[model samples]
Target chain A: MKNILIASTSTIHGSSYLEYILDDLATFFKDTEEILFIPYARPGGIFYDDYTKTAQKAFSKINVRVKGIHTFENPIEAIRNAKGIFTGGGNTFILINMLYKNNLVEVLREVVNNGTHYLGTSAGSNICGLTIRTTNDMPIIYPPSFDALKLVPFNINPHYLDPDINSKHMGETRETRIKEFHNFNTQPVIGLREGSWLHVKNDSILLKGKLSARVFEVEKAPYEVESGTELNGLK
Target chain B: MKNILIASTSTIHGSSYLEYILDDLATFFKDTEEILFIPYARPGGIFYDDYTKTAQKAFSKINVRVKGIHTFENPIEAIRNAKGIFTGGGNTFILINMLYKNNLVEVLREVVNNGTHYLGTSAGSNICGLTIRTTNDMPIIYPPSFDALKLVPFNINPHYLDPDINSKHMGETRETRIKEFHNFNTQPVIGLREGSWLHVKNDSILLKGKLSARVFEVEKAPYEVESGTELNGLK
Candidate 1:
């Protein structure tokens, strides 16, 4: 059975890192003593060690120890022996590139599928999708491929925002970009708002948190699904 | 000598398509009777014919005929013999992918370098940079590479937006994304606000329009450049 928490973001507005979801994380990782943190995303171009320390401080409040995968001699072994897994957010392209370069994609996916508690935030959650096509991040680096861990049947657009009605900027809105993605792809995309998350347990994936998620399908108009709605039958 | 007008957008907020830049275009494309339009970057998922027609309609106002590259059986030949060229905005990834797939990258670069009047909006303008790594569009398709025409020494972030001081969105700001790009690459980037453009005349590239553009350089704080400012010495 697959067990995962794919969150739209690690920190919500006006909150500390991972603070908003700490309670839920504490419950989800109750029996696990430590988490193998993948700080490959390196948010804000921060050093890997500093990024790992940030994750450690957050997990410490929940009485859980966090160990960065980079600290281990073998990342593959770290994933294999991890009681729980957590991947923090940053540039998605770099994260996926590093995952491929380190040959950790398959092992990470396998461990998570085998029922290890997995937590993904932002770029981390993006990899749970079929592809990273819908990411809002710049392609600072080209990954081996846009293919990501197929933890879920569909792709995800993290930190999805609604088009500002009063804004004058002419850049494509998040919704428009997803529509363009559907032009070349058929995979469904979940526009996950900052406060929302998908709780995946076995075959059931339920939308959690305070807000609704926008669901996009090919050749169809996008619609919103309220919190607590199950996404198992979405595709 | 290179004669090109790389615009941030085809249309500004509350203006008809190409209306704002039509006069400048008329002056730049003076003496040119027909323009070969590369509608590969179909904005908003519009068909090539429709997008071409839109360009045709806009250019008609300046008494210039527009022909989509798609209409020609020989795209490379058409580019080579073109009197002028225009590439509208859409998904940068797909546009660049098609350019490579059709083997037009080299020819287009060559023609533009040879002084065939060229106009680019949004995605089109992005390709004038060293790479399309700074584009804000979704990666709907993977290009052969992010390498672009290198018409200019630096990259461009079209439709550049300032960070909203009051907004609570957790996504990386435009400046932050550009900063991230600088972390891996040394190319300087110009954040061209809507209605702003870079007028490339031979070796001189000047910022044109009513708004100031932001300049981001590696290891240095980004600064603003006023309209009519010469970018010839930027690199």
Candidate 2:
């Protein structure tokens, strides 16, 4: 049985999302000993250490051996020996670049297909798409290249928001920029609002987060979708 | 007769594209008195001095007057005094960035609509699109930004070429990356191959330059198009 909890955040331990997934993790670890924690998105960022520490503390509370994969010089080996993989969020472009550079995208696909549980956060949730078009980053930075791990069918625009308080220093709104993307592309883009996430297992996607997410398709007005709704084209 | 020529090379007097447009320039300017050159793309580069030297040497042979617009910081004045505008190729991202930063996109649009004869090459050709999605540069390096002058109804990916050599050192193939773009967008993306140019006059797009250009649409296979075909989405 393949089980994957691709989350926007794992800390909902006391909330509905964390409650549901933590219960599942508790049950899964009843037999297994360790779960591999891959923190590839942060790369050299110092702040990501907090995300790693948080995951370590959370998993340790349940007697789960959570190992951080960043220390491994050979990431392929770390991925190979993993029973489960949890990707944290920071910069999806940076993460995807590293993954493509190391040729580990296929390896990751194999790991997911082999029934290894997969978990992801913001940027982590982004790599689960056909392309990183939905990303908030300006498109000029080519990274090493542009082949994202096509874990899902549509593009993921993480940290999605409606209108928020603007300080003027932030420049243009992301919504306007995303509309430009809609103007340029022919496929549907999923604007995954902060705290919202997609969970995939056995070809099923379950939405988890605070509220419904927005979907932007060309030639149509944007619409809101509920959690657990099967998105078009993903199947 | 709007003689709009889109050249593969910005300085056609010296460089060689598949189809030479320098000779055509002389024929086109026989009746015209002045030509306006937009060197915004090659900001801080030597286009103002270098390209003018090239054009001066060549145009003087035919007794034509050519001046680069680097002298006019105000685009309105530049557009008003010129018989035609010649847009040159450079770092397109940089060029569009400057245009957007200076709020000249609308100004240029108005100039073109006013029937000032217009010509463009490479980066200049790219700005004639609704978006700059097809560009190869990493979108974040913002010499100014990724925002573009939306003259055409679609995006332009210039310097477009097939991954002919399959070298590992380079990034993903342009086709694959654009397909990845299709996953998130519904708008048709025009991939103008190297040496290919689009000549637009009075709402008509006439393909010029080499043998053919490849265009990719969402959900459709890539197609080869020859000169004179109308671009689908351009208004």
Question: DockQ for all models, in order?
Answer: 0.76, 0.04
> Please, what are the lDDT tens digits per residue for candidate 2 over residues B1-235?
3445554445332344322565666666677777877776553556467866665665566676768777677767887768877777655656776677667777777767676677777767767666565555423223344445555666676655566463422223567767756654566767766556777666677777655777887789988888668764533
Query: Each candidate's chain B TM-score?
Result: 0.98, 0.81
Q: Pick the candidate with the highest DockQ.
A: 1
As a whole number from 0 to 100, the lDDT of residue B210 in candidate 1 is 96
Task: Return the TM-score for candidate 2, rounded to 2 decimals.
Answer: 0.50
lDDT of each residue in A1-235, candidate 1, tens digit only: 8999999999999999999889999999999999999998863334888998899999999999999888899999999999999999999998999999999999999999999999999999999999999899999888889999989999999999999999988888899899889888998999999989999999999999999999999999999999999999966
Judge the docking of candidate 1 as incorrect, acceptable, medium or high: medium
